[model samples]
Target: MASKVTPISGFQEWLPRERIAEQYVLDTIREVFELHGFASVSTRAVEPVERLSDQGEDADKEIYAVSRLAGGDDEARLGLHFDLTVPFARYVLENSGKLTFPFRRYQIQPAWRGERPQRGRYREFIQADVDIIDAAELPGHYEAELLLVIADVFGRLPVGAYQVHVNNRKICEGFYRAIGIEDVIGTLRIVDKLDKIGEDGVASLLLAAGCSQEQADRCLALARIRTSDTSFVQQVRALGVSHPVLEEGLTHLASVMETAAEHAPGVAVADLRIARGLDYYTGTVYETMLERDPGYGSVCSGGRYDALASDGKRTYPGVGISIGVSRLLGLLIGEEGLTASRETPAAVLVAVNDEETRSDSIRIAAALRSRGVPTLVAPKAAKFGKQIQFADRRGIPYVWFPGAGERGGDAVKDIRSGDQVDADAASWTPPAADLHATLVTPGSSD
Candidate 1:
């Protein structure tokens, strides 16, 4: 036997309750994506190495190469995908001929990264993503749509308040160029670290990139103006939008904010400073943060790219958002206050009256299942008390006890309130609320 168990760094597992929270996030993602007309699809976890090559050096390094035993070789060029977008782009390219234009998809799966994990960052994590790919140029309204849907996802969750940090690479670059900073693309790389390295570190890098203190401070100040409202448009104007590029960025942000507010009221806002650390995005970028928990950072973030994917013929301009499912679930589950109703699917467990009469219990279970209830039967003909304990452990609140005689055939118990009554197996109804899994209400303290 091995001397001890091995625990890998930067990876975590979920216990039952934690798994329930994770499942809740996944379920809500599917619901919201479908409600917005996005069809669901998933791509293989591994992809050709070239697929994710369009990312930054940091993102590229995070690609966890597949093991040699898994068909990887010195000549083989494939790695586990680090994010949903890259494989999605490849999926679109390889199957473009078959797919309809303006393809909308939602993917929920685990992604691997070889990174130094921190508070909410992980090496092996699950991401929930939704994207819209268009054959022609996608309007900025789609950008707002991406943020609106994702914001609504977390907004509906039990997590505390969150704001979608909105920005445009166009706006940031325009503002940079307008402010006379050369190599705007190179400068954005350094400034993206403002959250990690601090203003002083970014300023030093800006100086290294030949930005003057005035220009550096202005760029830093611009990145700092996040809002969930249209106030940033006014703020950017005060920053002097004389440069046409900065003005364009300003107008684009105003348009996105206006559309989001109208369609998904109060869901998005303009923050001139949301530099989405990726090079591909030429337009709007979004990052959502839990209002009171910056420690968890942006639970969802993505941006728009005009030409990130194309077949050298038609361009597929795209915009998307990804929610760090495992991370957000991690924050909510053991949060000392968050709660989920069920750990298993059984809404009601049918009690066994006697070992000789196991068929009676199975009959009762079928009755509940017919009523669209999830019912679990005892493994063996156990005592009534044993079945109740089993249901209680799994948090299956309602237990049905088969009656002794013909007229008194079915009786049920609500384990939570300890309420019991004789009712027919065919038509007896569990309380409306107890009929299905109950999601904890937002900001609930149970």
Candidate 2:
């Protein structure tokens, strides 16, 4: 039976050109991650439903439950993981004995969420995550290091003018407690909506959540504190609230900002309102925003979780940040028309002059490929113009015509400029820029 074709609202599928662009981004991320000494790891897509539900912040409501379509009875409940962190925690617990302490790993995978889809949100999406985990104790320096890692990745990509907003749960918890608000997590959950809901809205929600009007106003004031450097410590002090936890948070955040300034200046900001809604976050939290489009929401976010993974006798503490690959690409490729130099990786298409000499074309392609040039033979022996058109349509810059030169050797044409020159398949090389697919954005020179 023929199946009906339709576009799923939240499922993202890209064309050949867009896929090439995405692969370029993914490759860049993997390269940077490996260069920083993060080992790659992957976990199963489905986790136990109870495990998924146990994650805080209403995560259970968005979990996609999985059940056998044709099974007898007594099957365990399972669900597609909504995010990588939960599964990673479980992995740490299961492999605690086999793995070494202070493990540094990178995981790039797709996660499913059954929440409402929006401009940059999808039901299924790819998240590239880097985390450093240690048994019992994780260094505060790792929090600052993770920020630098993100900065390194963004610097290598075309993501323009972004900042990693850093905050600490201790900051929010201590501030709330100082103001006599007992439900720190619940209050943070409401305050996390400050961006979605304005100050007045958050105030109302806070008041409704058992906070006095004075307390709600104070919370809003704290959420509004944002600074580009360690000056935020003084600013928080000026709020006139004092607590041991708040003091501890201020010292930690200052160290993070100071280290970031020395290493990755202008890329880190101390934004107190970034209370990552997840309940697991115990200390540092991060949310990244592209200055060009802050309304697009955080393209990368994560934080420190001290007790998310514990096996009664031991605890694994870690810090991680996730880049929303699908969300970022959806904005760049789908909305802004970003793409790759060509649909295929081939930089030079070896033209097939005639069916009898097709073997010659294949041999030429092999020679060029052997020399590290991406080369492909034309599929059919058509007119030179038609063959060239095929290459042009796919953005293939150079096309090789066998026996077209005066010496009956070979000639390559730069389709963009209509320049053809005699060349040898064994020695000819495409320009470095043309060797692989290059990204083409709105402002790109290509």
Candidate 3:
């Protein structure tokens, strides 16, 4: 009997060409992260279940537990991390003595969750994250810097017209308390569902949660406040709610929006409703969405955490953002037909004239490879026409002939254009554009 092979629902696997395209995106992300002076760090995939579960509201349900099939009862409980941030918090604690203050690091890794799969939501996904952590206290300017960092990243990618919706937790907490609502987190969780359930639904839920009709209406009013500039400060003030925390949140959010407007125009919006569900985020939360579809959940998000990582004596407060690499690629490459120019990276395939003279073709390929040109030798001593067909099938643009030039030296043919010219293996170079596989999207001018 033969065993059946099946793919799990949420684990994504791409074809060869698609994988090459994915690498291009990853390389670009890594280069930009380095340009900003963020050091790379990788964390273990699993953490103690207790630590993972403490992330906040509704987080424990998503954790995928890990246990050995034959392990004894003494094994410590573990679970695959739902996101990179949790493990990163633990990493800081274990290595705090050796790390410098205001540490900056970037991590790119896969995370797992047990949630039901849906569009742009996956059980297994890749996340590219950057965080800045400092001992005891962190500066507020880091929040503004993170928004610019995300803008820089998206500006380089093909993701067109996205906005980072910004909000401060203090604004919500202070405003809720001013209006006599006792449950700040509970109200935030419901308001966060505004996109899923419209204004009426949220109002009903708020009322059901024991908020007075006026309080529910007030909460809805605050969530609806959104602006592209620092003007949101006045908008909150117009609502006639006042608290020291609310005043502090207004000032903080105003500074962030002002910085974004001056440095990264049109990239950040002050959206008061963006109360991230995680309990760890202390202030300044963000959620990014494409301009074309406001409902397509956030592709990048994070926030300021004042006490996520702490030792008995010290605390590490930080602000960070994560790009949902898998979700972004799912929309770009899977549905939008983004791909690479070739299935293989080889730019030139050397042809063998005969079985006895195949050594000549191998030597030519070796010379090309030495010069950093991606080259491959013919698999068989097939006819020249058949060899050309093989190169074409694999999207290899050029085919090299060992000794087919007019002067009996050597030649290379651009199979796409049918242009054959004399060339030398030791000195020849492919055009810069042809040297490596290039990412492409359907209907793109490039």
Candidate 4:
């Protein structure tokens, strides 16, 4: 019988090349993060439950509290963080004095949530996060730039086509309040399900949340309009513009659109519709989708949260975006045929010439490594044919053979193209382009 087994669902472990493909997604995001001048920082994976309580943004429902099997009476609890943004906010508050203002940083780490997992959702998943924090107030340009960074990352990635849908919290909440809807978060929670549930479902949801028939109609009416540019203001203004909250919403939408056109143009648009699920976002909010596959849920999303973090003395305003790396990797590699390599980690393999010259094989592998090529020596002194096959199976591009008689120093075989030639380990190269991995981007799918 199999060892008494229990498998926790929604958790996954990666093998060699699968992990390489995973790293490709993460590493791409890191490069994009640094290119935009954001510094790098990582927070402890667990934080005191108090720091991540219901006081912040509303959705901490899936927090997993830690426990030790060996028990003690002094009780303490910590939750594995749900998202990078909250941990980052606490970090900024704790070290505010030592750090510079308007902190820009990127975090790449795993988070835990006990939610029922599905195709792209997980009990544990890594998020690539970048946020900008200011001591007092953050400018509108920061809002525009944040979306631009997100688009830049998505644009460069090897995933399918996508667009970032942006909205201002003030705009959405104000519009709701102006229309006399009291529970805006409740309304947003319903609206957030619109893409998943369709128009009628959201209408029913709003009605269930005690919104008036006219108010629900207006809300669904607003959610119906999706545009590539920011002209959403004029159309929404045409809908009905008597309320101050609606008026303010239009103005803020105009501001974001104007700035996006002037600076990070065309990356965002005012979807009078984009009522992101969270309540913490007080200003601009974002949701990105693959144009062809919007129902797969947002590939990246975030918003501006004003006054969410405070140093007991002053408030720290923040705005940023996060991309689901594993989520995208699953789609790209699994569905889109966007794979880095199916091979194990080695880049090159050296042939072993029996027991006598295993040392020679080691020397050749070392020489290849010194030339900036990752190399591995064959496990045993075996026949040249078997050694070559080993290199072939592992996706190692070049195989090296030590010269036996007068065949020269080393022989290099290009496993991919089946071209074999005499090559000196120190002087010869397998082409510069092949030496470095090519990053697959959205352009590749076309």
Tens digits of per-residue lDDT for model 2 on 124-162? 999999999999899899999999999999999888899
TM-scores, in order shown?
Answer: 0.92, 0.97, 0.97, 0.92
Instruction: For model 2, give the 10-residue run with minimal summed lDDT.
Output: 67-76
Off by over 4 Å in 1: 70-74, 226-231, 264-266, 440-446
Candidate 3 regions off by >4 Å?
none
Report the error of model 4 at residue 62, Å: 0.7
lDDT tens digits, residue span 1-446, model 4? 68887888777566555567677678878999999999999899888877666643455677888868785758677889988988998999889989998789899998888789888788888889899999888876787788778877877676656777877767667768878888887788788777688889989988888888999999877777766666777677777745676666567667767766776566676675777766677777888877788778777888888877876689999898888776766677656656555346566788887888789888888888898887889997778888888887766777877884246666777878888787888877777656744444343620
lDDT of 3 at 403: 90
Reference-based lDDT, each prediction: 0.79, 0.93, 0.92, 0.77
* Stretches of model 4 off by over 4 angstroms after superposition: 1-6, 55-60, 242-248, 258-267, 404-407, 436-446
lDDT of 2 at 341: 81
Please provide the root mean square deviation of candidate 4 (C-alpha atoms, Å).
2.8
